[model samples]
Target: MTAPTTMPKFSKENSERRRIAKQARRLSLRVLIVCGAAETEKQYLEGVKGLYRNPAVAVKIKTRDKSPLEVVRYAAAFSKSDKDDFDEVWAVFDVDEFDIAEAVREAAKSNVNVAVSNPCFEFWLLLHFVNRRGHLNSYKQANALLCKHLRDYDKAQLDFANFQDKIDIACARAKDIDETREKPYANPSSGMWRVIGQISPGSHA
Candidate 1:
């Protein structure tokens, strides 16, 4: 055998390629988050799931309707052998100013990593987030005035019948009670999160 040959440091190109590959590997995985809602609100869950489907993704799904609270209380993986469990935990929640309401104040104070969509976060899920690329105005009158914005066309074909016209008929009919509670936390890409609303296993969001 010949004497051992010395090797040079990694070429810049090779190092750069490795860096890019590492970044790609890091970003490849995703996670799932569950929200609470009414029985009729299962559509929200399905809608989110349909839009997001990646093999490397994890899920923090919270079932709503019949067992919304129960799911929150017991959706985590548990250990049953030798009083030991090294399983993964994947889910998170958030707290809002009003979430500090007298009823849930003590719980909120704990600063527990609550799901972002607690209290009225569910309403945003129903109205807007259901469609990734859609907008839902709060006021009925605004909906009517902004008819030009809706492409569905005609009062009969729209999501809500007589949408704005009906709102004009009743006071506060178009009031968005949760509008005040609809604060959006920063997404992972945005780098502006002092929040815990979006739950992802091994994720920074």
Candidate 2:
């Protein structure tokens, strides 16, 4: 008769730790962005998501016609509503006519992030072509500049092929401006890159 087989030592704690790490590697990032359903914002974000084609990242865009504070509240509420809700929720809006301070404060309480563009989001798009240094008085002025570079520019069309190659440059320019400015959300400023950075390759978030 063969001698009784000896059992190998196995650490339950080590097994559990390995399981958690494996799950983390498989877990995908889901982001919900509430941006008043603006076509321009939706198209641009979708373009970025499409370009990456990463199976580990998912991006959903939601639109609301409410005030900035309301948008922030909605995003926060949605994020807390379910166990399978988005991993990150963002409120994207322009600081044109609304007092965004209250929204920013509320977002902090609700654990929601904000990606605000001063003047408008067009400035962020314009950065793809040129590194602008001054304030764009209005969205119109920003759009005009973008048109000069992007022929037949229209928000309805999600064609960002022209800007895709230069996205890295745009991100760098935006970061430079953000660092030099006191109020990062002021005119000629945009925090969109923060959201974009999360979905970029090699991002653990």
- Over 4 Å off, model 2: 1-26
Instruction: Kindly provide the TM-score of model 2 when superposed on the true structure, using C-alpha atoms.
Output: 0.82
Model 2 root-mean-square deviation? 7.2
How does model 1 score by TM-score? 0.31
Please give the lDDT score at residue 136 for candidate 1.
27
- How high is the CA lDDT of each candidate model? 0.32, 0.83
Model 1 C-alpha lDDT per residue in residues 1-205, reported as the tens digit of each score: 9998998777999999999976755655333333334331234333333443332443334443323333334333221121222123222332222332332232243222333332223223232212221232322432343444445433223343323232222212112232322443311011101111122123332
Clashes by residue pair, model 2: 37-63
lDDT of prediction 2? 0.83
Candidate 1 contains a number of clashing pairs equal to 12
